[model samples]
Target chain A: MFKNGKCIFIAFILSLLATPIMVAAEYGDVLINNYSDEAGMRPVVFPHWFHRIRFRCKVCHADLGFKMEAGGNQINMLKIIDGEYCGACHNGEVAWAVENCDICHTGKPGQPTQVHQSTASKLTTTTKRKQAESVE
Target chain B: MKFKHSLYILPLSLSFALLAAEPSWRTLVEDGLHDPTSPAIGVLQEPASALSLLPPDTTGNQVSWIRALREGYIEPRTNILPETKIEVLDMDIIMEKTGELSLVMFPHKPHTEWLDCANCHDKIFVEKVDANPINMFAILSGEYCGQCHGAVAFPLTECNRCHSVARSSFTGKPGVQPISVSD
Candidate 1:
């Protein structure tokens, strides 16, 4: 005795859950999990907007040598500690020091590296938050 | 006397167990304004303290980043060092290899507005030409243009935006699609 409209709506929502799609993320936001997931840490959720706001693209892209592709850059903890990549500016003086691991390593565990897309951003609530099968 | 002591400890242990639980902070990782100061008293802020003052856009990251630039909402430095000379490459590359659809126009101007030549030259484009033969499938799979289009720039669904040049207008004949895409 459910309303016809309500029944269709429920079915539609359930069908969405049954299907796995790309995880929606904010534009420019990236989840770096090249090593974090395997190393027993949360994926590093890099908010490009935050960094780009203060610095220009070349500051990181060219100068810091970060590739355009997500997970493309082979970033590791050792390299950062060696004053490269993120460590270039993240040193004590230019920006916050790297002692607070949680500040950057904030993504859900097991999240793969990817750039947030527009299509799925709306469906973020409906997304299963599963591994990025939709990507690779 | 022992029974009275046990009675006091049971609730105490239960409350202690509950207090030891870790709180989830998932939202902090999501894309939003993580404004700590609350300086903009006018705009609405997320409970976790993100100010939504940026212009709203429907597609690509859901924020009109370019519009924000035009509005003078942000001024991103060319580099950490303010003295570094910044250059913009004013050029356009047409991909006549697009089958049936209009030719794809890759504009260096707009791209250089946010990025430098080094960002794409050797890494993404690799000397332009068909050296890195590109196709819609490759782009859709997040390889070429798909790197930014499907993710942050604009979804590939806006076909006409890139495929702007009409095939009929070309001088001789529109170039044929490449037989095999080089790696």
Candidate 2:
């Protein structure tokens, strides 16, 4: 009975810790759609987990000038091709070529991209509105 | 008539002396500390010269917060915050009415200069929105912002510095929701 209690306690602790980790993992799967869907291309489902395993958060976030918040960085195809933002690492020699659109843009049609521009804008507007309302 | 003449002469001479001793209105403008036409311009002007001031000794024992930050003595240095680009985020949190206190205009740029996101994230403060109830009492007791802010960081005594956001500006208006970037 004592052994069973210990096992249950450990399982409870593990679940408590794992619950937050499971939630955080979702943030890693960011959708890069700065100009994809807007320009008739599918939005890129950038898997943060793949990069995070090899590189530290500072590598892309700090060294490469990627904003922590999604859609915060004004990334464009021209900028990427010019070897400025994503092109800094996604060059033919470093990681992958910018020409590889299929790799990043792996979203299906007929369904709205998970990271919609309108939703993000609405969130910002809502936050601002809520703040303004509190003061009144 | 003689006494009156002396009195006038004395007052005139003193005024002349005062004008000669005082810096000219033009001189004050040249120093970038004044604008005769708009007195408020001086207050709005950036103190670019402040950076030129020599940094104090930061030996990890006793040191001023501003001096320590200026001299690059804080942790989570280049290895952590490799970005040279300074991102200034205006994080304005409107708290429940407690007393007559100005809202805090948290300038993220300055803190990011010396520390990384991890310095305060997930440890001192949870990344989740509306998790921490950070108040002055909790801060003084060494929680949330108080973890670094009063210990190695800037002291809480400097009220106006953090609470610089004018209360009148936010009065009767909703405040901006706190932005949480999950780490």
Candidate 3:
């Protein structure tokens, strides 16, 4: 009985150590917003993990001089479409075209999904590439 | 029972007396704080030539450039100019556990030239000295002096920077050793 109690106590300590890793794994989404004084403004969310693998930090942050703090960078749709901020890279050659608004805006709240099937399919292709590289 | 009640009341009465003796809010604000005669605001108010490359709107539809410029550049000037008057403060480092305080005078002006005002102001030394609550543990953990001493400015590996002279009898661990003064 003494040996069984000691084993249970050791297992409890090991479980406590594993808790932080499990909590971190659950967090995978990114939240981004252009600083606005307006009361209600839906900010765009850019997935960090998806972009980090494709581009370097200096490409967007240091090169563009985006502030280190979140909600600091000033971004507009017109500036982006004109190949200024995100448009500089997402202009058909790098990722997705800026003409496709639904790709980023993701549509209004409770609205029907306007799916960009081409971008979604391309994402799968990139994921396959990453998996293939990992296997090697 | 009466003695115990008086003991508790004594601390409460003393605290009330101390509060009554404290300066009023208006007096504290007017005289106690470091009221600079002419506080120099760092960063240029006008748009510099570097920012001229940004696109302009013809109809004034876009946000004002001046407003954007002001929001971006709000920093206080550090008083470390060559001609400015500076006072050096002596600091003590315990070499051993003798409870003895050694004195090493710190130069203000030269150090300010290399650091931004935010680097020390409100962080290491508060605008008011009595308001400063610097924890040595926080400084060692990279909150105050540790921010630059170990990074871009200098590495705090040397022993003589803060201590200046080695004490023959002292024995306690060093707080934060000064890095290279020179670039």
Candidate 4:
């Protein structure tokens, strides 16, 4: 009985480790899930590095008016077809048209739009020696 | 006979270039009119002349735009509208919310050079100082600074860039307050 319980514990721990990797995104994959879950569709996992391959930062952020945050822009099918945000380029003109539903929206369900490898934890890596003196 | 062979190559290559759907949109989407690859493809016109022609970087995107801009290789327009006025504000805010890590010094000079105030104000960060809840965990989840630092900007690996101020030498700047836990 003891050996069986130990084996079960080991199996449970292994499963826990595999869960994060099952649908893990790469470093620059941004999973956007604001409206996707409610609409019964998979969240869009935008490959930031892929787009960066050809364009500069200002091309999308400045000229195209894309907000920096995930789900920052009110992206939807109607707005996309009408020539806004992604539709500006993906509208069967410069790049491939959004005919295939699975192209952009292929993230796991219920994942909030976010960067796969963001700077959050890395920023806190260094332990503080002392807190700064408070100003009166 | 040699001249005839050369003539055959030119048309052959031109056909291949024109066979693809409309000229690439690298520079087209920005201004709807500039297609550098077309017409000039035969002459090997630097398509996307509007963009810097620098060789793509091996690490990040093929183009090192920040370096290109900083080194004055290219001049990108701040806005699509030519006549729109751009206001660049200079403000420095400090955050002491970090437990033991160095205090964060947030500056607006470089950011305003490229972005409008609305890009972050009241959206990513609250206009009123200390109103927003900021922490490394929230940022890792793509909140606050994480939205841009990891996505577009220089990235989060360069920690000292933001946490530059040493607690001992920090005399504090005017009009700036430190971020902390309580209201």
Which candidate number has the best lDDT? 1
What are the RMSD figures for all models against the true structure? 15.0, 26.9, 27.2, 16.6
* Candidate 4 CAPRI-style tier: incorrect
True contacts kept of 4: 0.15
User: TM-scores of all models?
Assistant: 0.65, 0.33, 0.27, 0.49
User: Residues A1-136, candidate 1, lDDT per residue (tens digit)?
Assistant: 7899999999999999997643434566788889986888667767765665567788887777777778888988788878888888878878776876766666667655766653344444533444444554
CAPRI quality level assigned to candidate 1 from its DockQ score:
incorrect
1 or 2, greater by DockQ? 1
lDDT, candidates in the order shown? 0.65, 0.50, 0.38, 0.61
Q: Candidate 2, chain A: TM-score? A: 0.60
Of candidate 2 chain B, the 10-residue stretch with the lowest lDDT total is: B25-34
Q: What is candidate 2's lDDT per residue for A40-130, written digit by digit as tens? A: 7655555442353334444566566665545667888788888876787788976778877656655432232232222222234656846
- DockQ numbers for every candidate? 0.20, 0.02, 0.01, 0.08
Worst 10-residue lDDT window, candidate 4 chain A: A127-136
Candidate 1: tens digits of C-alpha lDDT, residues B39-145: 22223222122214566555554456666665767777778656555788666666787789998766676677777777777767887466778887777776777
Best by DockQ: 1
Q: What lDDT tens digits, residue by residue, belong to model 3 across residues B1-183? A: 999999999999999998775422121112111111212112111122222333332211111222332244212222312343333222322223213434232344334433333445664566542354444455444455544333222234432454454455434444332542222
Off by over 4 Å in 2: A1-27, A109-136, B1-183
Candidate 4 lDDT over B25-66, as tens digits, reads 132212212122223223322234423365444222235554
Q: Write the per-residue lDDT of candidate 2 for residues B79-142, one digit (tens) a residue.
A: 3234444343445444434357776655555565544576567766776545667788776655
The best candidate in terms of TM-score: 1
